[model samples]
Every structure is written in structure tokens, then in C-alpha cells.
Target: MEMEKYFRVDKLPHIWCPGCGHGSVMMSIVKGIDKMGWDPEKVTVVSGIGCSSRAPGYMNFNTLHTVHGRPIAFATGIKLANPELHVIVITGDGDGAAIGGNHLIHACRRNIGINVVLFNNQIYGMTSGQYSPMTPEGSMATTSPYGNIEPPFDLCELTRSAGANFVARGTVYHLPKLDSYIEKAFGKEGFSYVEAISQCPTYYGRRNKMKTPLEMLEWQKKNSIDIKKARDLDSEQLKGKIITGIFAERDDEEYTARYDQLIKSVQGGKE
Candidate 1:
């Protein structure tokens, strides 16, 4: 765990609000990359505008901070233009599941070689506590004073159904499990998605009466059940519970590899 090697030391002290779980989730990403032994020079991190998108600013690697909800698109292009590069996308609930949602689905359908780590704070924390696509029904937010009537998207299940080669979910409170999911996602040959459930104490907590970050973290611990144990429970028993674990993983033809084969066929092996 020589973290300095993977972080921009000059960027010491991030700007995330106190009690935010994003920092932990961001560290898990770095740990995954380090454990995989991937050369930083060959890795590229892309992000869209949001609290989570700031990760690339501290990461010591080829990085791109893109427009809101479009990091996946930018990452896909980078991967296609030079298939040798390992691309990772850091996006948030509002940035990924709302505006950039279509891009997320298509990337999964294409099964591209990119790792998408979504930091789901359940609210648009960067945008001043607005409700996001991942905000739970009946949740309070700047945009949902009367409680959010819309159901939240189960991002892991969405990606799994959309053809992602690997899909998983974990909470910031469960750091080791989160890190393991990310590491596994990085090792997949095709499109992989990991939803890191993060706490937004300043915005989400203050609005929902959680009072403190510790309370939010405790809520996650009490509500989350491993995917293995979840199977033994009925739907009623699982209600309001966060199921954390890998949902899908399969050996499939990756987008870049398939594109390369098509190019070879079209040019008789000449680039």
C-alpha cells in the first residue's frame, strides 16, 4: 500500500465536505489499481462533473475531467482509439444515472473494456442537495421537500441486465468489500460496473435527520446484506436492505478486441 505512488501528493487535502464517504470510495479505486499491478502510465481515469468526479484530480495517472454525465462516452472513445490503455470512469448518481444514463447503458451493452465506478451518494451533493436518480423513495432533498416519490434505480442490477460483463455493489462503510469489488471489476475483460454507495452527510444527512456522518455509516451497516446471505431471505425480508456483492460476471468478447478483429478483416491485418 504505497498510496503516494498512485496519488498526486501535491493535491494533498481534497475539498470534499467533512463526513462525506467519497474519499473512502476514491481510495478503494486506488487500492484496486495498485493491487492489480497496472502501470499508471497505461491507465486513464475519466470523470464527469460531480463530487465523485473530482477523483481524477488527486489520482496520479492519465486523467480527463469531462462534462456532466459523459465520462463513460469519453472513456469509451479513449479505449477504442487506443485499445492498449486501461480506462476507468468515476461518476456519481446524478452524473451517471440521470443525464449520462443512456451512455451508461450502451457501454454495458457494448461490453467495452472500461471500469466504471459510480459513487452513489443518493443525492446531488455537489449541486446543493438536489435529489438524484438514486435517491430512495420518501427521501428528503432540496428538490424533494415533500419526500421523493420516484423510486431509485438499482444501478448494479441495471448494468447486469444491460450486458455488463461484471457488476457489483458495496458501501463505503465496507471498505475491504468495496475494494475487492473494484479490484475484480478492473480484472474483467469487458465492461464492468461497481456502485460504491457513499454517504453525503452535509447535504443528505442534514436533510434526512441523520445528524452525523457516523449515523449514516451505521445506517449502511445495519441495512446492507451480502448477496450470498440475501438469497436466503424473501423479498419482504430484503426490503430497504442494500444487497452488496457481485451480481454478474461472464467471459465475453470485449468491444475493443472485437473492433480490432473487424479492422484486421477489413484491411487484411494492416492497421
Candidate 2:
């Protein structure tokens, strides 16, 4: 496929640091969207304040770069107004799981028709280097000079448990499969989520001793375990491994459709 069709050429030269995994992940998203053959004008991209949020600006779509941690709320409104639109949210670990955690949970619980692609780099890259909700325990950051003491949130597990119709996990290293997951999410009728494990070489890497982006990617390649492979291994064998794969899929009536039905019933067929 000619990649130019999927991007806004004027937005070339993205601001993400060199060797950062965000570029590959963004490409995978566009590839997935292209495969789905959704009309560009009908696709809406929403995002909160973060590095990942910058993606919507680079894409040729109806994009909304919203306030910190509130993209889902705004997206909910958009979906309510026009259920036909394909709404996708681009968020970071800090933006989605910290300040916006409440909204994320409610979005999953409501099973709204929106695809959330969480770019989890494990730290607040946009703000220099603060520890985020997905930062692994004992990882170093500017906020956690010694090591991060808080436990990380497993996004897929959380979303699946919260009733999202579909949830999947993938790393930038597994980009082709990541594209597949995004495509699957976009096709689902209810709330869907894909957590794209990204690498932040500029901030997270420098603070965490991953001197170069390649080193961080190498570590990811070595530590990540496919969910299928993980099931075969005992807990002891899987210690400290990153599990990547589809974690859940359910067919639920989307919130917008159900709400419309309720309104019709309440109005007794009146306008």
C-alpha cells in the first residue's frame, strides 16, 4: 500500500525523539485503519494531553486533541451525537491510567463504541520523566530516583475485567500483530481497547539506564512473552515477562445503540 494515503504529508517529521517506538506504532494503526477501509472523513481520532495525543494531529481525520485525561469523555459525547462515526482514542499511560483512570474504567464499563489505543511507555515522557501507572515496580524515573514503588496496571486485564467488548495487548516489536489487534478492535461493535507497549528513549530510557533506544528494544524483545507461550510456562518461568496477546472478546450491545432503543421505547414512537 502507498503509505502516503494514510498520513497528512504536511505533518511529516513527527516530534517524537529518534528511535522512539511511537512512529512504528502509529504506522501500524494507520495500516490497520487502511485495511478496514473506513472512509477517512468518517473516522474520528481523539486524544488527551501527552506525547501519544500528538498522533491525531498527524493523521488525516476528524481529530480532537482534548484536555488531560478527558479524551474519552469528549469521545463519548461525539459517539452519542453520531453513532456512525468510528471513534478512536490515542492515550498514554499517564494520560489514560493516572489522571484519566476513572474515565477509562467508565468507558470500558459502558461498552461505548470507541476504540482506545493506549500508548503505554511506562513513564510521563511528555513531562520529562515522572513515574506513570504502568511503570513497572522498581523502575527508575525522575520522580522515583531510587525506584518506582507503585505496582503497574495490566491494561488488558483491567479493560477486560471492566467489560470492554474487546481487549488486546501488543508491543511495538510485534507491530504486524499489533495492527491486527487494532483492526479487530475497530471492527468490534462495543468498547474495544489495544494497549501498545511503546518505548520512550528520550526520558524513560535515559532515567531508567537504557542508554540507547536499541538497548530498550532489545530488552523488550528478550523479556516479552506471547500470551500463548506464557500459558504453557509456569508462573515461576514467566516471572518478569511481558505478556502480549488478545485477552478478551465479547459481543455486547453497544451503549449508543441501546440508549437509542431506550429513548425510542420511552418516547412511545414519538419524535
Candidate 3:
């Protein structure tokens, strides 16, 4: 199937700012979809309010551009209504981890069969640069003129703890590896979470003096460690480190699977 057939060019010249890593993420998703050989009609992409949210509009599939911080809820509904469709949620740091945090946690806890691609640019790119929940401590943002006073949430750890069946972390610079992770997530049967550490060159880059998107990419490359190596690092050595790769995975009953079992048991009791 021709990949271009799945794109909506009217939304052309995507809304993402120049040098934004969100573009890389968009490409990775497209590539993953193609590699999976998924039928576009059988797939649905949902997003909330953010640069990442605009992604669903550009894709030629069943799409939902929902309210801010609610893509997970929408995705959940769509998946429950038609469990056979491959549902993917595109969300940003603020939209997913901050305001939408409750939904994110519940989705993971339910082990719903949905693939969530979380774009973690650290700062809120669409809201004129406020510090997001994943923004590192001491990082400058519009809200943090001096620097952020609080520590950031480790997204991978949060999702894993919430009981997501699959959890992984990757950056735009690691596109090849990220594509593989995304494919794995799509193939997984239960809640699959990917925190894609991306760059917001316009806001996050300028404020932090990362200056350009390339510089931010370089930072990610330098700071990120393979999961295996990260596990071996002592606390002191692991400071300021970003671990990339699949952190946790397990094969367990998905939400629908458990539901089916309950129905069967109830039917047997009735008989």
C-alpha cells in the first residue's frame, strides 16, 4: 500500500514549528503503521490539544481531535466500541502527564488494548511555554522565569507502576530504534505506553538555551543510556541520566479478556 495514500495534505505544512521534533515523531508513527501493514480503515488515531494533537488530522484514518487532556478517554471509548480497531493516542507532556494524568493512570491500570504515543517535550509548546509535569527541575519556562522549582515525573516509571503491560522510552534522535519500539507497542495486546522524549525548539529550546533543535537532539543523545546500562548505574552515576528502551513488559490478560472471562463464568452459573 502506498503510504502517501494515508496522509491528508490539506492539513499540509503541518502546524509544528520549524525544527520541532514532533515531525520526527509523526514520521515514526507513519513508518510503524506501514510496517505493521494495518488497514487504515481499521485504525483510529485520537489526540488532545497540543502540537502533537494535530497529528490525527494529518493522518487519513478514523480520527478524533478531542478536548485538551482527554485523548485517552476518547481513545478508550473508541476502543471499547470497536475492540478490533487499532486505537492510537497522540499526546503531549502537558496534555498527557499534567492535566490528563488521571486518565493516563486509569488507562494503564485497566490494561486496555490501546497504544499511546506520548510526546514528552518537557515544556508546554502550545501554551506559550509553561513548565509541564515532565519539565526538569531548574528548567526555564514562561511560568518559571527563574527556573522550575519542582522535580519532573519519570514517565516510564509512572506508567510501569500504573500496570501498563508495555512501557518504553525513546527520543527523536533515536528514530530507527524508536520505530521498532512503536511497532512492538502496536503489536502488544494490553496497554502499551511510549514516552517519546522529543524537542520543542521554539519554546523549550530558546528558553533553556538549547538554542536549536539539533542542540536539543545532541543533549538527548548524550544524556540517554541504554536500559541495561542504566540498571547497572549507581544512584550517583545515574543522576541527570535519561534511560531509553523498553523498561518493562509482561503478557497478561487485557481488559477485554478479563471481561470475557467474567461473562463466561456468569453464564455458567446461570446454566
Candidate 4:
């Protein structure tokens, strides 16, 4: 689909597991960038350590593979330094919601002009099937052989409340919706967050009895409900359903622009 030029041919065989959904999520991001006709040189993709983090290596753009759970922090710096660059952060649930969570909230709070695409695979796919903060309660993982007891974070709601200008959630099964959400995020002027629910057949699905990638994808299709329809349903009816769609969008002043204005004001006031 003309996506080959967006990728590094040398990095052609990615290291993700067979049937992993991260590839689809990464494709959605690339598709969004391509649709916008953004220059590869003006775009910067930053990622932290995890299966989803490997995407930047494949993309033919300015990329940074940062330390575990810190891509948001690095991306923030990159945006602050060069407001003209389109900074897109590719982070996994383990890398984003666990340790890097603080950065995520604050970046949303400050309304930085960066796009964060969280690949929510639910389990730490690259680290041998460990449970992540987005892992649903009662889900089994290598670290939670008895089933995870902690409730998963509602990332879309979290980011929206934290002040992100745009917040949306989509699953790999809903490819078109996922692509639309990412494209909308890229077009937003302030902090934007897209939760791309992905599947980890090798880790999450296997341990949870889903077994195959198709099974996992089917599960997503059955469990997902759009936000517009979700509002009409009661909590009981919505229970166990993944609410997908944009939860928030507002025209708030972005951090970098505010900083630039501050600099101008200070300089103008100098006597």
C-alpha cells in the first residue's frame, strides 16, 4: 500500500512474535503519517523498550529507541527543543503505563504538542509474559500464574482527565478505526493520546487460553463498543466491554507555544 518507502528495507523482518498485533498498530501510525503527507525528515518517532518499541527501527524517519518506560520524557524534550518537529511516541503498556505513567500524565497536563500511541498488548510480550498495568484482572501471565488480581488502567479516561487535547482508543481488529484515530491525533494541536489495543498471542493469549492471534482478535471485536453507543448502556451492560472512540478533544493552548510566548514576553520587557 505504498508503505514500503516508509520503512527501512534493511530492517525488513521485525523481531515481533508471530501473529503479534503490534505490527498492525505500527502500520496504522505509518498510514496516518503518510496520509497527512508529512515529511519523513520533519517527523520523529520515539519509543521505549518493549515489543512495540521496535517499530521505530523499521520506520524510515528520525527515530529514537530510548530507555525502558521513558519515551514520553524523551519525546517531550524533543518537542520542546524543536517545536516544528512532529514527535510521535510509540510505547507499550508495560513501558508506558507502569514506570513511564508519571510522564504520560504530566505531558497530558502540560498539553505538549506530541502524539503518543500506546500499544496496549496487556502483557509484557518482550519480557517473557509478565503482567502489565493494562492487563485485565484475572488474566494469566508468566508473572501471574494464578491470574492477575490488579485491575487494568482505563488509559483513555486517564489521559482525558489529565488534560490531553485528544484521547482515543482503538483495537487492531478495528483497523480502519485505528487508522482514523491515529490520523486525528496527528492533526491535533496539543497533547494527543491513542490507545491501540493490541494482541500478544505468544504471551497474553497463550496464558489466557485464547491460544491464537485470530482468537484474540475475535475477542476484541466481541468485547469492543464505540463510545457513542457505550454512553447509552448501563454499567452492568458495559461491564467487560472495551469502550473505544475519542473520549476527549479540546482546543487548549499547547505547551511549546506557551513557552515561546513566555520567551517573547520576557524579551520584550527587557529594558
Candidate 5:
């Protein structure tokens, strides 16, 4: 199967800054789709407004570039309309967790069959480097010259609590592992969430003195731990660290699957 056939170059060159991790995450998504050998006509990529949201435009499959922080809503509608289609929502930290946070939680609670690839760069790369909800406290950003005052949300914990059927996290530096997690997410029957810890060198790098995109990537490589071994670490050692791998998974009926069963039962009433 030719992978290039599913890409759309007219939207290029991509808007992401040089050496941005979004490109790496995008490649993982493409690789996962290619591995699945999914029919392009049966796949729909949806996104909200942000650098990461532009991802759907680069794909030749059915795409929707919706308003900021609304990709989940659009994806839900699309999936409910035709549960057979593979619906993927590509969103950034700000788009998925900040402004669109409510939608994210509700979608997970619904247990809908949709795949969400969250590009977590930690800061608001777009909109001029503000402190996003995922930005680590004490991390410097354009808006937080001194340091970010608020704590960052643990995305994995949040999703798991919201009832997501599958939750995983991987960084751009861990491409092989990231690809595997994404592939698993695609196969899940209910809401599947994969958080890609990406780097934003142009903005986040300059603020943190990482200076270069490669340096940021190296930082992630050193700071992240495989989830399987995370339990061995002491609390102090694990603080401010990221655990990467499949964190939670459960096999259960999706929203539509349960609904279909209910409809059939009602239609075949014995009374």
C-alpha cells in the first residue's frame, strides 16, 4: 500500500516551526494508519484550531478543521452518524485540555468509539506562548515571565478518571513506542486517548533555556519512564517526571454498541 497516496500536499508546507515535535507525532499517526491498511474512504480525521489542529488538512481522508477546542464534539457527531467509520481527533494541549476540557471529559464519559491523539507540547505554542493548562508549574512562558503559577493536569489520570476505555502516553523521542500506543488506541472499541508529549522549540525552548528543539527532545528522553517500571520509583524521584506507555485499558461496550443492543431489544419486545 502506498502511504503517500493518503496525504494532501496542497496544505503544505506545514505551519509547525522548524524541528517542532508535532511533525514527529504526525508521522506516527500516518504510520499507524498505514499499518492498519484502513480504507481512506472509511477514515475521517478531525481537528480544532491550533498548530496541531492543522494535521487533518495534510491527510487525503475525509477531514474536518473545526473551531478552536471543538474537535471532540465534531468527532462525536461523525462517529455517532456512522459508527463504522474510523474517527480520529487531533488536538493540542490547549485545544484539548484547556478551552475544550469539558468536551474531552464528556467524550470519555460517553465511552464513544473515537480515537483522540492529544499533542501535548506543555505550553500554548500558538497564541504567542501563553501558560496552557498543561504547562508545568514554575515553567517559564511568554505570559508567565516569572513562572507558571498553576499546577499542570496529569492527562493520563484525568482521562482514566473520566472513563476512557484506553489511555496511553508517549513522547516524540519514543517514536517506536508512540506508534505502538497509537495502533492500540485505533483498535480499541471505546474512547481511546493517546497523549503525545511533543516539544515546541521555537516558543517553549526559548523560554526554558533549552534553546534548541533537539535539546528539548533529549530532555524528554531522559525525564520519561516506562510505565511498567514507574511503580519502582520513589515519590520524590517520580515528581515532575512523565510515565510513558499504556496506563489504562478495559474491554467494554462502546456507547453506540450498547445503544444498538438496547434498540434491538426494544424492537423485539415479547409483549
Candidate 6:
């Protein structure tokens, strides 16, 4: 089937730079939506300010371009108001892990049925290439001229510890795997976090010695290892390896479901 049918064609020529992997990750999301055959009107896409936040504008579905670092906050309200709708959040490393870190962690803690497609470009691509929470230690950005002293977030572990029902990681270099992860996230019952490590050649690459976008992707390909393979290796062997796969999944009760049950109990006593 033609995947373009899911997108608003007029919104073509997205604002992302050439070779930026955000486009690929967005396409994978669209393909997952196509697989689900969900009605556009029933799906709500929420985004914060960033290159990744521009995704909701290109899609034909119901969308909300919210304030920076606040997509999850808005998405929470959207889901709570209408439990039947499929709410998805699109956010960036800077927007999600940096300014929105509290919201991101709380969303997982609440186990709300919201799907979060987190685009981790490592650097702040939208606000002139600043160092983001996901920026690898030693990686150079505008804010980190010499090198970054801060250690990067292992997002999968963070979300899992925060109590998400599902957590997965995929790189733009692995499109099919990314599609599969998104599909799984869409089907999840509680807070779902899917991390997509995208490439920002224009900023991150130029600052980190990866002169071309392809070179950045090549680095991802070399550094990443499947979760299944990682189990066979020791922690020392796994160092510097980006582990990709679903990190966790659970059948815990979603927030709305539990709330509805509470309402039913109160009404039952009333009657």
C-alpha cells in the first residue's frame, strides 16, 4: 500500500536537513500507523518545539504542536479527556530529556496509555546545536566546544525504571526494526517509550568530526548491537555498544482503566 496516503502531501519537503534521520523515523511511524489502519480523526499526535516536533504538522491525523518540553503534559490531558483516542507524543532529546525530563519520567510512572516516539539526535539540532541530555560524553556541540563532561542518558533504562509498560530503542540505520518497535508501542496498554537515535549531520556531525551524514549513520551501524546478542556478552564487552530492542513490557492497568473502575465502584455504592 502507498504510505504517502497517510501523510498530508502539501506538507511535503519537511523542514529537516538532508540526511537527518528524523525523516526516516517519521516515515517508520507512518508505516506503523498504516499497519494499524486507524482512523486519522481518532489518533492524536502531540509534539513539542524541535525538529522532531515538526512531525505532527506533516501528518494528516489530529495534531497538537504544544509548548517546548510539554508535549507529554498535553498528551496526558488529551488521553485523560478521551480514553478511546490513540494519543502519541513526538519529542526530541533536548525537548524531552532536558527540559521535559520531569514530565517524561512522570508519564512513565503514571503508566498512561500514551505512545512516545522520542527522537534522540544527541545534540540540540533545533536551537542552534547545543549540548542535549542525550549527547554522548566527549561529543562536541556548540555548548560543549571542547567536549561534553556530562554522561548521556540511557533512555531505555530510565523509562523502564520510571515504570513504562513498554520501552524500546532503535536507530535510523535499522528501519525495519524501528517499524516493528513502533508497532509494538502502538499496541501497548500503558505508557510506551520508543527511542530513535537519529542523525544530525549538519550540527552534530560537523562538530564531532563526522563530516558527512553517511559517516554518522556508519558510526551507528558499527556501535549498535541487538539486545539478544548483548545478553551473550559481559558488561565490559557491551561497553560503547548501543543496545537495540524492547527493554521491557508489562500488562499493568492503564491509568484511565483504573480510574474508570474507581468511578464504577463509587456509582455502584450510590445505586
Model 1, 1-271: lDDT tens digits are 7768899988978889988999999899998999899999999999999999999999999999999999999999999998999999999999999999999999999999999999999999887999999998889999999999998888888999999999999998999999999999999999999999999999999999897999999999999999999999998898778999999989899999998899899998786
Model 5: worst 10 consecutive residues (lDDT sum): 1-10
TM-score on alpha carbons, each prediction: 0.97, 0.96, 0.96, 0.97, 0.96, 0.96
Candidate 5 is scored at a TM of 0.96
Candidate 4 regions exceeding 4 Å error are: 269-271
The reply for model 1, stretches above 4 Å from the true place, is 269-271
> What is the alpha-carbon lDDT for the whole of candidate 1?
0.94
Expressed as tens digits, the lDDT of each residue in 106-175 for candidate 6 is 9999999999999989988988799988998888999888999998889899999999999999999988
Error of 5 at 134 (Å): 0.8
Candidate 3 Cα misplacement greater than 4 A, ranges: 268-271
Can you write out model 2's per-residue Cα lDDT over 142-164, one digit (the tens) per residue? 88999988878887889999999
- Stretches of candidate 5 off by over 4 Å are 1-3, 269-271
lDDT of 4 by residue, 1-271 (tens): 5756799978878888899998899889999999999999999999999999999999999999999989999999999999999999999899999999999999999999999999999988887999989998899988888988898899899999999999999999999999999999999999999999999999899888799999999999999999999999998898768999999989999999999989889899664
Candidate 4: minimum summed lDDT over ten consecutive residues — where? 1-10
What is the C-alpha lDDT profile of model 3 across 1-271, one tens digit per residue? 4646788877788888888999889888888888889999998999999888888888999999999999999998888878889999999999999889999999999999999999999988987899988898889999999999998888899999999999999999988999999999988999999989999989998998899989999999999999998888897787667889998799877987777678889899564
Q: After superposition, how far is residue 164 of candidate 5 from its true place, in Å?
A: 1.3
Poorest 10 consecutive residues of model 2 by lDDT?
1-10
How accurate locally, in lDDT, is each candidate?
Answer: 0.94, 0.90, 0.90, 0.94, 0.90, 0.92
Flag regions of model 6 displaced more than 4 Å. Answer: 232-236, 269-271
